[model samples]
Target chain A: MIGYLRDIEKSFPIKDIGKRRQRVLKGISFEIKKGEVLGLVGLNGQGKSTTIKIMLGLLRPDRGDVKIQGHKPGEIDTLRHIAYLPENPWFFDNLNAKEFLYFIANLRQIDKERLKQEVEEMIKRVGLSGNEKKVIRKYSKGMVQRLGLAQAFLGDADFIILDEPLSGLDPEGRKMAKDLIKGHKKKQKTVFFTSHILEDIEQMADRVLIMNRGRIIKEVHRADLYNKTLEQVFIETIEHDRNN
Target chain B: MIEIIKLTLKEAKREKGFYAGLILLFLSLICYFIVESFAMFEPEKVMAVYALSSVEGLSIILLFFLIFSFLSQDLNKKGIEYMLTLPIKRRDYILGRFFGINISVFILAIISTFIYMLLHLLMFGVCPFAFLIQLILLMALVLMLSSLPFLLITASKRPTLIAFLVFFIYVIGINLDDAVRFLSTRHGREIPVVSRALLKISYYIFPNFSFFDVKIPIAYKLSFSTMHIVFALLYGILYTFFILLFSIMLFQNKEIK
Candidate 1:
């Protein structure tokens, strides 16, 4: 397994005078295999993002273990192989797109000689060719997402975790994003991404996990995807879970 | 760590607070020159006092504002998530931000000090070496003082609350000795043993910010020992190191939602 979460549980403390904790994930468990594109699909607050966070080691699980390639998440060695694009990517507004990518590359310890060339290539690859000099604050929502995607792919990471990678893209931008993920697949990289668009999961995912109320209520494989559309399966699964 | 430091310095340079500090320094110099031209009494001394106080006040305010605002924005807006997701360790992030802000503060202090020195030379035809040394020491103290905000932000996420705490601590730290002396002497024999002990503990608890206020000594050309400067330097280094360590501890466990 490239990464796996075993009986992971998480809760957030409500900021009231009296302490109150809201359990967000209730013992969710899953695994990712190498070179596989795993899609996590769910409603707004069904712990999809939380699971991703735990996998990335951004949030510690209250119970159970999370490991990346046998090492704990957020470990230096483990993190080196992983790249993440947050749902709403926040960057240093002072830096331009190219500068921001360079910053991430430098943090990843990329060679100085290759840094410039790699950043430029990623910028062009993400369709941000001419906007490389534009400061992040000036970029539109879609441009920021492109820049985010550009940085996430900068280091040739073995594992890519994207949270709503298609959130702000227009139709053309979405196609570009899909193509980018396909390119990652061609490289045999393990990808775990969350998306609201079922078509994205249908087109890109090797396996899709449908989560509801903090549980993985259903799983759909690529073979099953040939039989039914992801949207149909998703709606039916969620509605079925709700009815029960 | 170096990359983070570089990025942070780049970010700090673009902040309005940094520019505002520089502009304030320029305006203060202009005001000092205007005041010097219309001096009715002890013009040089007045200029010296005005220069040192203005530089100290402006630098401290700018440092506090910049560190607080930057850290708050990073945490609240989730900018930190991008950095934390990298291979860098959490402690490296804290140390990088610490050094980055300190370097910017040092640069600001140097520029202000240069302006002060230039003004002093133009007005008095002589710049005292002792005053220069005192100003450098004060800048070191300011750098140490700026570390508080990083630790504060790590401890609490509320900027308003952190600002209030910072202001309160500054006020208390500078007057700690006076408050301690007053409490100890005013009650002398009448005070309870526990209260006296508490007062004694409070005296040592807050950073003795008065140790860094060499403005009065510099202004009056009073003689001070080299040992005092060395001790103050050591104190600032030790204090900053421990605070940074504690900040790393807090930040390591901080959950990003």
Candidate 2:
């Protein structure tokens, strides 16, 4: 298993001085196998992002356990093989594309000798070669998303986690992102991404997990999805869960 | 960790505040010069006192905002998510930012010192070595004071709240000793015993910034013992380390959501 989250429960204190709390993730559990493309789908306010954060150790779980590559989440050694691109990705606006990529590459401890060559190649791969000198603040939203993709794919991480990776991209950008994700899969690397676009999830994911109000309502394999559209299944699942 | 430090330094260079601070420091020095030139008895002494104090004060304020905004901006914008996801220990991230911001503040100090030295050389002839020592001490003081924001940013998310809390700490830290001394005096005997005792305890516990104030000594060119200078620098380093440790602890458990 590349990642495991078992019986995870999390809640946040709603008020400053009291124990009043709001539950975000309740008894969530899942696992990602090597080279599997797992897509998480959920409505707004559901615990999809929270679950991802828990798995990444960005947010501590109130109960249960999580491990990434046989190590606890956020472990330095474990992170060496994982790369994450957050939802609505924000980067250091002061840095140009090349400089920002270099920063991430250095942090990833990429071979110093290959760092320059690899960063340049990734920039070109992300179609950001011509605008490498422009500071990120001057880049358009689509450009920033491309830069986000560049950093995520840099360092040759074995597992790539993307939250809303397709949100800001135009048609061409979305197509590029899809191809890049496919590229990761072709290389026998695992990918865990979340998106509201059901068609993209259906096309890209080996399996799709549906979450509703802090619980996973259904898990559908791509083979099982052949008879029905994922959108139809998703609606049926959400409506059934709501009526319960 | 070095990457984070380098990133912060580059970000600091790109910020408009860095250049604005440079301009403000020079403008404030000019104002001090003009005001001190009117002093009939000892203009250079007055100028040195006001100029050094102004630079120290300006640098502290600048450092406070720079350090606070750097972390707080990342927090607010969710930029920290990208950072924490990297194969980095949380402690390394905190330390890297602290060192980076501290270095930038020192750069500002260097520039201020150079200007002070130049102005002194042109107008007053051969700046006193004692004042140079005092400037170094002043840099240490700035380092100590500026570190509070690193701790405060981790503790609270609200910028205004952090600002007010840091301002409160700065005030109490700088004045605690003075407050305790005043309360112990005959004229201050009417103050409540509980308040006096609390102030005294705080004076002993909190980092005493007043001890680092060497403006009067710089003005008079008063000789300081080696032990005194060493103790002040050590105090600054120790306090900064304490604050940084606390920030790392808080940040280790912080939820980026």
Candidate 3:
């Protein structure tokens, strides 16, 4: 397994001046095998991002075990193999695309000889070639999203965890991201991502996990999704769970 | 860790505060010169005092806010999430930020010291080596307190409250020895025992920033012992070390929500 989360539970303190806690994730468990493309789908505030955070050790789970590459989340060894792109993709606005990618590449410990060439290649690959010198603050939302994808795919990371990876992209940017995922799949890299776009998930994910109310309500494999589009199945499943 | 430091330096370069600080210092020095011109006796002496005070006070305030905003903005803007996810240890990240900011702090200190020296030469016609030593101590003072915001940001979510608390700590800390000395006099007996004890306890708990203030000695040309300088350096280094260790611990366990 490239990743695993067993019986994960998480909650955050209420924002108000109270001691109350609002549970965000309640017993979330899933595993992503090597070379598999797994997608997590849930409505807003359904704890999809929170689950990703727990797996990356950005946030601790109240209960459960999370392991990546047979190591606990956030361990140096585990993080060395994992590349995470957050849902909102906030980056230092002062650095230009090349500088920011170089920063990430340096952290990824890519070889000194190949660092420059690799950063340049990724810049062009993400369709940010002409604008590599422009600071990220000047980039449009779609451009920033593309830059986020560039950094995520840099340095040959083995397991890529992307939260809403395709959220802010335009059609061309979306195509670039889809092609990048396809390229990773061709290399037999494990990719786990979350998206609200069922069409994208249906096309990309080998297995899709449907999360709602902080729990996975359904799991559908590409081989099992017969005679119905993912949208129809998702709506039917949510409605069925609600009625029950 | 090196990458983080490099990133911080790049970010610091784009920050306008560094240039603004230099400009602010220059204007204040000019203002001091004008204000001291009205003094009928030892006008140059008065100018020197005010100029140095301006440098010290402005450097302290500017450095505090610069470092505070640097870290706090990263926290608020979610830039920290990008940082903490890297294949580096949290301790390395914290130390990298600390070191990067201190490098900027060092640059600012060196530039302001030169400015003060030039101002002193123009006003008094004799710039002693003590000015360099005294201002270096001022840098040490600010450096020691710079780690405080790191600790505060990790321990509390209330940025406004933390800002006030940092300022309050600076005020109380710098004036602590004076306050304690004044309290120990005849008027001190009027205060409650518990309150006085708490005050005495706080004197030990908080950083003794009063120890680093050498303005009066520099102003009056009074000699201070080398031992005093040595102890102050030791105190600043040790305090920063311990506080940063504590902050790293808190950060390692913190939930980045």
Best by DockQ: 2
For model 3, how does the per-residue alpha-carbon lDDT over A1-244 read when each residue is reduced to its tens digit? 7978999999888965678999999898888899988999878889988888888888888899988999988889999999988887878888899999988898888999999999999999999999999988899988899999999999979999988899989888899999999899889998999988999999999999999899999999998888899999999988888898
Docking class of 1: high
Task: Calculate DockQ per candidate and list them.
Answer: 0.81, 0.84, 0.83
For residues B72-100, what per-residue lDDT tens digits would candidate 3 score against the true structure?
66777777777778888998888888877
lDDT of 1 by residue, A37-126 (tens): 999999999999889888878889999988898899878898999999998888899888877888888877899999999988888888
Evaluated on the second chain alone, the candidates' TM-scores are 0.90, 0.92, 0.93
TM-score of each: 0.95, 0.96, 0.95
What residue runs in model 2 are displaced by over 4 Å at the alpha carbon? none
Residue-wise lDDT of candidate 2 within B1-257, one digit each (tens)? 78788988999898877887888897887796678668888887888787778777777777777766785677778767778888888888777777788788788877787788788778889765565776788777777776777687666767667767777888888887678779868977988888777877887777788878787877877766788888988998898888878888888888777
Candidate 2 chain B: worst-modelled 10 consecutive residues by lDDT = B126-135
For model 3 the TM-score comes to: 0.95
Better of 1 and 3 by lDDT: 3
Q: On a 0 to 1 DockQ scale, where is model 3?
A: 0.83
lDDT to native, each model: 0.83, 0.84, 0.84
Q: Give the per-residue lDDT of model 2 (tens digit) for A1-244.
A: 7878889899988987799999988898888999889999999989988888877888889999998888988778888899998888889988899999988898888999999999999988888889999999999988999999999999879899999999889998899899999999999999999999999999999999999989888999999976899999999999999999
